[model samples]
Target: MSGQIKYQWRITKYNPDYRDENGYYTLKEEWTCPSEIGKIIDGKEFTLEEYLDIEAKYIDTLIAFIIESGLNTLRILQLSEQKISTEDRSSVLYETEFDELILEEDKIVTLNDIVIISKMILRNFVHCQLYLKDRFFAHFGWDYYMYIGSSEKSLSAITIATERGLFVEEIDSSPYYFLEEDTTRLVQWSKKENELGMNEGDEELLEFPLEELRLIFNLSSQHPVVGNIKIKIEYKDFFQRYLNHKMDFDKYEYFFWGGY
Candidate 1:
């Protein structure tokens, strides 16, 4: 019978080491360690059979966990053969530690569970300011108003939408969709000439506050709606429309930037 094979799985910490004169690590501002260079924070050897089982089940979920946990990268190695691999080692192997994947009660949570947890948190609680880039079109002489809700207000709106079996995209094309920093968003739009069919007297415009439009997306984590929320303005006094809708000024405020 052949000897048992094993594998070493490690997570590299992104600690930049930029030394000055004597090879001592310098200020954090100066450090820009290469992606390949990092100290292994946690790891252990697993039998080949054990590793195979993990690869079959937790590999993808574990990778998602690593990214969500703010880890730099994962490294996997064949201990028996002394082979090293990084990045997309699918042709060779893949990575994330089993230890770090565990949740309370030793319950292992999938990427979806993590997303639900985040939405639940934002739904019940809130932070002061959530800065977001506004991307929409407005015509001159048209009135506009924003639904400047707190993160909590956004969550409540999202929860209502979710219960109605609706995704934010179905509710509004450019609804308040907040994406993670690393996530890339590709948006495309097509317009037919005269589709708007604007009449001469249609100069006045009013933007309704669909509180249900705030849906956060993190496709990386497998959560379409992760829960962060934004909106627009024409005249300053028009903000009273939002307050008239029962929005609490003490907890939220209307804010925006840029003009066309």
Candidate 2:
């Protein structure tokens, strides 16, 4: 119950006076009226439970429907057809968001109905550019969040390796594998691909090997100055090598990183 909860919507337009142990009055799905700060919903307020009810039951549905229907975030939020019952709380995406997506359902749609209906949209499908930290960032699409939950002990080990300085020097004594510390990357250059091994496949997203995923670490924690490094293998060549050795981190390093 206490790990990262996956959420795609950004909360805005809520009251600031209310505070939680986690430091917010409550989460709203979209822009709220500034005057509605005391309330959980943007234009109006509801109890925390009310908000949770909206999220647990309808949030995923909203994402699913919008992606399936190719609609805007606000349009999906406000759609009257999405409501299941009167008892269900109203949506902030509906209450405040103010526009529609002028889409004819793009011609190049993936043919998988189940996946189209089930998956949340990760990458932006439209053309866009952003300026962050003095650089121009451009992207036509973005990726869905990757969840790689591991055993606590394995995660602890990974965390340590990510922090280790000159970990490349410790390959011989390393328990799982060696981590390389590389120079910090530019923020604008990092968003073009999935930070974790590029989606497995555009359709199913079969998980990528950790070795491929691990190479992108520096892109994620860039400003923090954490350890990330170049694996010295071309991205095009990674999968061929990965499939040859069964894709386990074990000895893959003994073979790949250390080149032993």
Candidate 3:
């Protein structure tokens, strides 16, 4: 009998200090697609439209699962923030114990539940994003950590991996900036090439909205073996069209990839 195939959409969070002898750490929450569905084509390049077709077909289902199962935990955090804001207006000192707050059936929630939900949302988002954008994936033992805080408060939230860290970065900016570097570079290059006749420094790189960044991060982190993947497309007409129409094609040709 043949072994059953398995596929997974996975995203991971790593302990910053969890390094091996070579300075590589284990990535937590690695998701994979079910083997039955098979892997994406290894080296083929798809047009932006072609990739979006795949995402439109499959991403919603995955996103629905994550939103339904994982969003509640995040909601709990939102609720906490709301409560804090309300208390600030009344000048009430916040005194609830962390354990006690979490235990209250109506107020407190489990970190375990939040972690599970976060992982689910992240995996689904990654799968969907990869399907829509061209991307290059690479892997090494190194990871990045970021601390997110509101300018109004001393408290901060930290994200320990590239995907989550980038998501946090995009919370205040646009998502388009987070697309595959090739797309961004191409867009910038195209812009520069067109503005060559203008005074130096007259052109700026195109900017994307914050939501797009969140979407991209959510989508890129879904795979376990990302290093072998990349989406490279030839933009034969991009330069000519940019000059002729003064329109940007960079927004359309996004790509991404990942690895263990």
Provide TM-scores for the models. 0.17, 0.17, 0.19
Q: Write the per-residue lDDT of candidate 1 for residues 89-125, one digit (tens) a residue.
A: 3322223331132222112344444333222222221
Superposed Cα deviation of residue 21, candidate 1 (Å) = 14
Best by lDDT: 3
lDDT of each: 0.25, 0.25, 0.26
lDDT score of model 1? 0.25
Better of 2 and 3 by TM-score: 3
Best by TM-score: 3
Tens-digit lDDT string for candidate 2 (147-203): 111111133333332333101111112121112332222111122244543323211
Candidate 1 least-lDDT 10 residues? 136-145
- The residue pairs that clash in candidate 2, if any, are 13-32, 15-37, 32-42, 123-142, 124-142
Regions of model 3 farther than 4 Å from truth: 1-13, 20-23, 26-120, 126-149, 152-260
Pairing residues by index, what is the TM-score of model 2? Answer: 0.17
